[model samples]
Target chain A: MRIITAEQISAAVAELCIRANRELPEDIVSAMNRAAADEPWPVAKNTLEVLCRNIAAAEEMELPVCQDTGMACVFVRLGQDVHIEGDFRAAVDEGVRRGYELGYLRKSVVADPLRRINTGDNTPAVITLELVPGEKLELTVLPKGFGSENMSRLAMLKPADGVEGVKRFVVDAVRKAASNPCPPVVVGVGIGGTFDKAAALAKHALLRPIDCPNQDEFYARLEEDMLREINSLGIGPQGFGGHTTALGVNIETMPTHVAGLPVAVNISCHVTRRASMEL
Target chain B: MEYRLKTPVNREELNRLRAGDMVYLSGEVYTARDAAHKRMTECLDRGELLPFEIRDSAIYYVGPTPEPPGRVIGSAGPTTSGRMDAYSPRLLDLGQKLMIGKGLRSREVIDAMVRNGAVYLAAMGGAGALMSACIKSARVICWEDLGCEAVRLLEVEDMPLTVAIDSLGGNIYESGPAAYLESLKGGK
Candidate 1:
């Protein structure tokens, strides 16, 4: 069995948080370059240009891409053979606290949804775990800003809605989001499974690289179609006007009960930030 | 029309602006978002003075990242303005003339801006690192306990913005997309 220390995990998590906030992934940069180069609307083009500049500035100046540094979403893929040496949850929260402080990131979490008291340190990260067949532990930290998070939606459709209904719902979600979630957004969609499972799947779908399509031929076509339709809405870069509303559409699905067709759409802005490390 | 606004912008200056006008602002502004607005409104309810003057001043709906060493402020960008829709009308009633934010505002907030001869402008959303370069100085003025959500007094120079909603009730959020769609229909 591979043994890992809590301190090592925490330190790694802390660095991941800081690095993810300051750097734009390469695929995202390429997508932005394409959008900025080909956008037809003058205002939309300008907005895309500014977004590109922001990406560069974040790295050059060692500053975060957006002020809303967001809730730290740490995804862990652990091998069944690995054993952690200490209190894993506390170590993760400590890492989040230190990273938010050291990186000068915004602490956006509230202690309770209703109480509205600031957490101050941005602790208790939303951690997701999946078991894989290996001796290595893989970690991915995604800083999810609420601006786009607030626009995410899920609906349990009747089996009758089928694929067309899923497309309609996803498109409508993006349309209703408009300028709010920040256009040139990434749309992550999860179909099938139970209600909650679909939402989680939709969110994880965003972790896929922007240019990569689902391996399934049918789903890949659906992704391409949905992306085209979203851009056609003319929401543009910052919702000013044009044809570059979304950078990419990612879909992930699983088998579900025959009675229900649960679909979830999770929107992410141009500031889509994630970083990964393995140990 | 492209214009430069020096803050404490008067109603006359704002009156000349229209939705879709590109603007560069150079002057002082205060920053606030959902929590700060709630606090300010509650203080208003108790007849308590706010941390900053409301009349003729601009409030940016932003909660900035903490400044690192050698920086004036961290990535400072506009948050979604629609979240502030509940308290904006009240601030507008007090003669708050300018608001800097991103995204849509509610119908009532637009009506309130129209009533008060106010204007709402948008700094590009998620372009925080680029936007922070425009802020020359930033210092927390109140609610220090709120961390990034604290009210900050900022001095900005040549901060680029677009008038999303104007005093006369023109709204770019609704109109910009509509115009683009219409142009597409016209085969542009």
Candidate 2:
């Protein structure tokens, strides 16, 4: 069995947290550039330009792209043959604490949803683990800001509601979100499965690269159709108004109970910061 | 047209602005997010004096990252404004003239702005690194225990913003998108 130490995990998590916050991933950069070129309104175009410049400045100055350094969402895909050498959860939280403190990134976590006391170190990261086939442990860090997170929605539609219902719900969510979640946002739609699974799938859909299409022909077309419709809303960049309301619509689905048509829409801002490492 | 606005912007200056006007704001402003606003309102309820003056001052809805060594501040940007809708009308009634944030405000908030001759401005969302360059100085003035959510006094220079909602109730969030959608319908 391949053995991985908690120290190694902690160090890697810290580095990834800092790096992900500062750098705009290449795909996102290219997508924004394309959006800027396609955007028609002058105000929207200027907004996109400023967003691009912000990304560039963040990289050049080694600063975070957005002040909300975000809740550290650590997703781990562990192979069956690997054994972890120490306390896993505590090590991950420690990594986040060190990362936020050392990188000068914001510590945005609170101890409770209602009590609202700052956790100070941005600890107790939202960590998700899944078992995979090989010896490699893959880690992906997605720093999710609450602006968009607050805008996410889920609805358990009856089986009769079908595709049109899903379409309408997704469109309405984006329309209501307007500039709140920071358009041109990424729309992650999860269909089928149970309620919680649908929500999780919707979030996971956001982890896909902006340009990648779903492998399924049906879902791929739905994504395309949704993207076209959302942009047609003219929410534009920063909601100043134009044609590029969303950078992309990504859909992930699974088989669900015959009676249920569960769906969730998780919106992500233009920054959409995420990074991955394999060990 | 771009404007260079100083702090304690009078009602006359605010009334002259309209939705969609670009602005480069300079001078002192205060920072508060959800928690701080709750506390400030509660303090106000108890007849306690706020740490900073509210009259004619601009309040930015932001909780900035901690400053790194040698930098005046860390990445600073506007937070979602909708969350502050509950407390904004009351604050606006209490003589807060300008608010810097991103996103939509409620009808009551807009009505309060119209009634009070206040204005709402939007900084570019997700453009924190660039925005921080405009802030020349920042220091926590109260609620230090709240960390980033503390009330801060900031001196900004040429901080770019767009007039999202004006004193006259001209809301760019509604009108801008409607106009663009209408233009598209006109085949522009």
Candidate 3:
């Protein structure tokens, strides 16, 4: 069995938290560049240019790309053969604590929803673990900001509603979001499974590279169709009005109960920050 | 078109502004997010003095990241402004004339702006690193215990913004997209 220490996991999470905040992923950068090139509105083009400059400044100055450094979301893939030493959950939280403090990233978490006291350390990261067949442990850190998170939506439709219903819900959600989530957003769609599973799948869909297509031919085509319809809304960059409302659309699906069809749309802004490492 | 604006912008100046106009704001501005706004409105309700002046001043809805060494401030950008909708009308009634942030505001907020001759400007959302370059200095004015949610006094130079709502209730959030969608149809 491959052994991994809690300390190693903590240190890796810390580094990832800092790195993911400052750097724009290459796929996102490329997608934005393409959108800027194709955008028809001068105002929208200008907005994209400013976003590019922001990315550069963040990288050069070693500052966060956005002030809302976001909630720490860590996804872990552990091989069945690997055994971890020490408290796993505690290590993840420790990493978040150190990362937020050391990186000078914003501590955005509140202790409770209604009471509203700052957590100060941005701790207790949202972690998802999956077991795979290997000796390696893989970790991905995504700092998700709330502006887009607030705009995400989920709907449970009758089985008869099908693909058309899903499309309508997604398009309506994006329209309702308008400029709130930051336009030129990446849309992660999860279809099928149970209600909660579909929501999780939608978020997981966002982790895929922007240009990558879904493995399923049907879902890939749905993604493309959704992308076209969303851009047609003319929300543009920052909702100034243009042809590039969305940079990409990603869809993930699973088998669902015969009674219901569930779908979730998790919107992410242009600076879709995520980082991964294997050990 | 771009205009260089100084704080405590007069009624005449605000009236002249319209949705979609680009602006570069300078001089003194204040920072307050959801928590601070709630506190301020509560103080107003209690007939208590505000921590800072509200008349003709611009408030930025932002809760910035902590400053690193040798920097006056950290990455600072606008938070979603819709969250502040509940408190904005009251603040506008108290003579808060300008707001800088991102996203849509409620009908009541827009009505308050039209009634009070205030304006709303949007800094590019998520453009924190670039936006920080324009902020010359920042220091907390109150609620330091709230951490980043504290009210701050900031001096900015040429802070870029686009007019999202004007004194007359012209809203770019609605009109910009509508116009573009129409143009798309026409082009086709």
DockQ of each: 0.85, 0.89, 0.87
Local distance difference test, candidate 1: 0.93
lDDT per residue as tens, model 1, A1-279: 999989988999999999999998999999999999998888788889889988998899899999999999999999989999999899889889999999999999999999988988998799999999978989999999999999999999999998899999999999999999988899999998998999999999989998999999999999999999998998888888788999999999999998999999999999998999998
TM-score of chain A of 1: 0.99
Second chain alone, TM-score for each candidate: 0.98, 0.98, 0.98
Task: Give the alpha carbon lDDT tens digit for every residue of A35-93 in model 3.
Answer: 88878887888889889889999999889999999999999999999999999999989
lDDT of 1 by residue, B27-61 (tens): 99999988999999999999999888898889999
Q: Interface RMSD of every candidate?
A: 0.9, 0.7, 0.8
Candidate 3 global TM-score: 0.99
Backbone clash pairs for candidate 3 read none
Candidate 1 Cα outliers beyond 4 Å, as residue runs = none
lDDT of 2 at B129: 93
Per-prediction CA RMSD (Å):
0.9, 0.8, 0.8
Q: What is candidate 2's local distance difference test score? A: 0.92
Q: What is the C-alpha interface RMSD of model 2?
A: 0.7
**Would you list the rank order by DockQ, best first?**
2, 3, 1
Q: Which 10 consecutive residues of model 1 chain B have the lowest summed lDDT?
A: B179-188
